[model samples]
Target: MTPSYGVRERTAPAYGARWSRERVETAALRVLRWLTVAFFLVVTLVPFYYMVLLSFRSIQALLLAPGRLWPSLGELTASTYVDVLRSMDEGGQGFLLFMRNSAVLAVLTVIATLLVSIPGAYAVSRLRFSGRRQVHFLFLAVYLFPSIVLAIPLFVLLSLLGLRGSIYPLVVVYISQTVPVSIYMLRNYFETVPRSVEEAAAVDGASRLGVVWRVSIPLAMPAITATALYVFMIAWNEFLFALLFLTEDPANWTVSLGLARLSGSIEIPATVLMAGSVILTLPIVVLFFLAERMLTEGLTSGAEKG
Candidate 1:
């Protein structure tokens, strides 16, 4: 009987033998990962979907069915977009002007920041000048200061220079804010470029500038594009500076400033506010999608190798 019991015990498999501890853990983690992804996707997309839905909905329909997630086709219209985009003189919110101002500031900031940062980053990376290591520390220190600390001084300086309420001064401020970060980013990318490539070009009678332009610039285009997009978004959405400088003149308002004004006012409709939000957000979304590959490469640059 004891021998028979021993035989029965040996013949029966151990409990949970097929599903080992590691296997159970792995399965749990896989399910948890998918659940986390789905939660975040819902969190991110639902608001934006509601926003787009509200933007298309009429005020009457919105008030009638405030909780409705889906608006009827008949209730949807582009009038909200029209209202947001049309000029104040045309009895609308005048986002078109705001868009233009934001565009100008963002474009100029991108250009100026890139122009300065590229050379600065290259010098910091490739050259052996005195205080070379300290330069990056200075850039980091400048960026670490709260932007609010710079705002009042900038406002006063712009006043003295008679540049307040002008997009040009806003561009200058953005350039100051963006250049250090741009240089930091570009420097990382530039450092990744092999010296052999530059030396080859230089040996072939190309100047130092030619070697950089022909070799480094092309190689760093992904990073440059990412930096430009970063600067553009900063300039486009900046509120404190825009408020400090441009609040006196509605004509000079960037989209962010205008949207802020709208949000603060009781008279503006929620639908219109949603429309303005879409207007402010849509360009960045479109631009990001268009350059998704380049941006991914740029962000991941040097992450593994460096």
Candidate 2:
């Protein structure tokens, strides 16, 4: 039998209305999610793309066509990058030296921060010590302390010790800045390691440190990797401390300091400044991409089946 054009649902009117409401909500949420994603993508990529485009062309072309969003092949010039990356002796900005210094400082900070924070975190998590429960608060307190406060004392100390212009002193400062937060993050991951596993390792004649190195570290590798990446980026992009320490010594300048100089120098064209910015940005970008897999990996994935 054919149904009437207008039919009322008698079995469950409330369920029909509720179901319609839920479907509408779900569809609306899905559209909102895509719109949000597209918005962020545009906000992030457009400025970076424009900066990159400007770097590939001459300042003359850019000024002549101020509103041009894209450039023709003939208008594009690689000289901006050449000047940015070349040595000062060759009448260029010498960013390669700056990049090298930054790389050294960042790598050293990562290593030293990991070394100090791992044991500190493990002890806070596992050992019975006075104020162990409250240790995290201290870490947070240290992290919350203003950088300027720390920088003043550190700068004075380094200068007194005749350590100015050396990257090692900067490395030490970065280590202090990073280690507290690293310990804070690593502590939680360390606590998640089963005491039984550690006990078994101890029963097998492993020392406390050995168990940490052999068993706990493997389990918490994902967290360790993430913390390292975090610290690396902090050291890589840190400007205030780098500027305070290395500003007087151009040879010891980091990418951040070099970029700052480019920005402040009127003789340096905006295109050249953009090139310096891209150079400063590339290492962190590459590192993030390389560690993206490790960052997303679960700490306890292999320990249990979900």
Candidate 3:
């Protein structure tokens, strides 16, 4: 009997071949994943780096050496930031006021959006209301509607009311834009929460409002944080309504509108505008990181499936 290429030898080759194929595929997948991650990081981070790099250099230096990626230590200056933050009366651009205005609008928008969205989301998620199904469709339609088209009507109305150049209108616009999405995100998370927990609370004679306040809100903390941060980012980065409403009043301009307006001017340096871009982008990034941490910690708590 030939022992060659029989049962024992064939089994060894088969095992080796399958193992080799699996190892090769796993290695390829890992490489692909890492490559995709690297690509994302570079795409996201390079523009930020360029903005910071140019922000530290003078307009003269930037013009003289537009292609340079790194500035010499001596070329770096705090003058750009100083010029940006200083008052217009002091011969500076007065972005500090713009920043303050933007901050107030964003904070107010966050508060109002969450206040309205939380109860709305809770109602939609828990209670079997008459218009329950239609509510989501309405929210989706509002969310999907073109903001610019809405802006046209808003602009016309505000202009007629002589409110076009105020931050108040901008805040209201931000809230309207944010509320639909907030309700949607929060409702999804609210639905995922176990109904049994609320029923148990109800058995203890807790009212609907009491249950939401004591039970649902606490349990949905992660989703709340995420929603608030999302609203904040939208309000902070909002440009169209800001431009439409506040462009006439430079004194009341938010950082976004201010940067956009100045971006078109021949008198302002590109490096200066780049500095403004960095300033505009920094706070949202910090808030997002904080929100990400909260979301991670929230998900792992009491998430064991039965």
Candidate 4:
């Protein structure tokens, strides 16, 4: 039989075209992924590196060499840290008080948020009630609203109540702002837990509260830890609420507000402010890394089954 060129030629060209296209797409995607990684690494690290470098150099050195990336050994000093951390009466910026205030507020907020959210989340996930759907909607609404908008009304209310500048009111605000999201996070994890386990505990003569205390809480410990860390970071890094509430009272200033105030003064050196920024950022970085694994597990614990 004579060789048929039509079928063989057409089929060969189509196969070749598909193979070439796939190879081209694969190579392009590989290159793009590396580029994206490099871009993010540079974006995230360069500013932090610059901040540390500037923090160690003298104001005079930075003024002399504004574009320099590295400071000479002779130009490096730790006085900026000392100056930023000491009390105002001691001829420094008084960041020690700022750190204390920030810590107290963050801790209190975390505690209060967890206290309210754990039970609230448990109820939402496990109970049947008339307003259950409405409650979920309300939480979603609050979470979607801009905090600044709510801050205005809260500021007015606090002022009327004579609690405007107090850290106590800020704690209340943080709890209200964070609790909705906290409940949402915890509720999802609660739903993932098997109800039979709770039933088994009940069969063993466990009271409702006892079952929740021993069974639900223990099962959701990872999510709770993650939630607490999240709440702490939010409260620690809060600037808008802190400024709105505490700006008039210098003694109540958190680290975020303190660093901002420092930047507004002509007398304060940039290097000293950079040092303050570093101090403010370090605790958050440490806490995040410490809880990172638990947070990851908590968030992904139920994903496979879902």
The top-ranked prediction according to lDDT is 4
Write down the lDDT of every candidate, Cα atoms only: 0.85, 0.85, 0.85, 0.90
Supply every candidate's count of residue pairs whose N, Cα or C atoms clash at under 3 angstroms: 0, 0, 0, 0
**Position 256, candidate 4: lDDT:** 99
Task: Indicate the TM-score of model 4.
Answer: 0.90
Per-residue lDDT for 1-306 in model 3, tens only? 223233442333658888676557767777798899999999998888999899888999987888888778888987898888888899878889999999999999999999999999998988997988898899989999999899888989998999988887777888889999888778878988899999999999999899999999999988998888888889999888888889988999999998988889898888887888889989988888878765444444345552
Residue 232 displacement in candidate 3 (angstroms): 0.6
- Highest-TM-score candidate: 4
lDDT of 3 at 169: 70
Shift in Å, residue 8, candidate 1: 31
Q: Summarize candidate 4's per-residue lDDT along 1-306 as a digit string, tens digits.
A: 212224332223558888677557767777798899999999999999999999998899999999999668998999999999999999999999999999999999999999999999999999899999999999989988898899889989988888877798899999988998788779888998899999999999999999999999999998898899989998999899998999878889999999997799999999999999999999998999999987666557658678
lDDT of 1 by residue, 118-218 (tens): 99999999988899878878998988889999988888888998888778878878888888878877888888889998999999999989988999899
> How many angstroms is residue 276 displaced in model 4 relative to the true structure, after the best TM-score fit?
0.8
Worst 10 residues of 2 by lDDT: 1-10
Model 4 clashing residue pairs (backbone): none
- Over the stretch 1-306, how does candidate 2's per-residue lDDT look in tens digits? 212226643344568888677557767777798899999999999998998898898888988998999779898888998999999999999998888998889989999999999899889888998887578788889999999998888889888888887788888889889998788778778878899999999999998889989999999998898889979989999999988888879999999988997698889899988988888887788888888765444333344556
Candidate 2 displacement at residue 251 in angstroms: 0.4
In model 3, residue pairs whose N, Cα or C atoms come closer than 3 Å (at least 3 residues apart or on different chains), thus clashing, are none
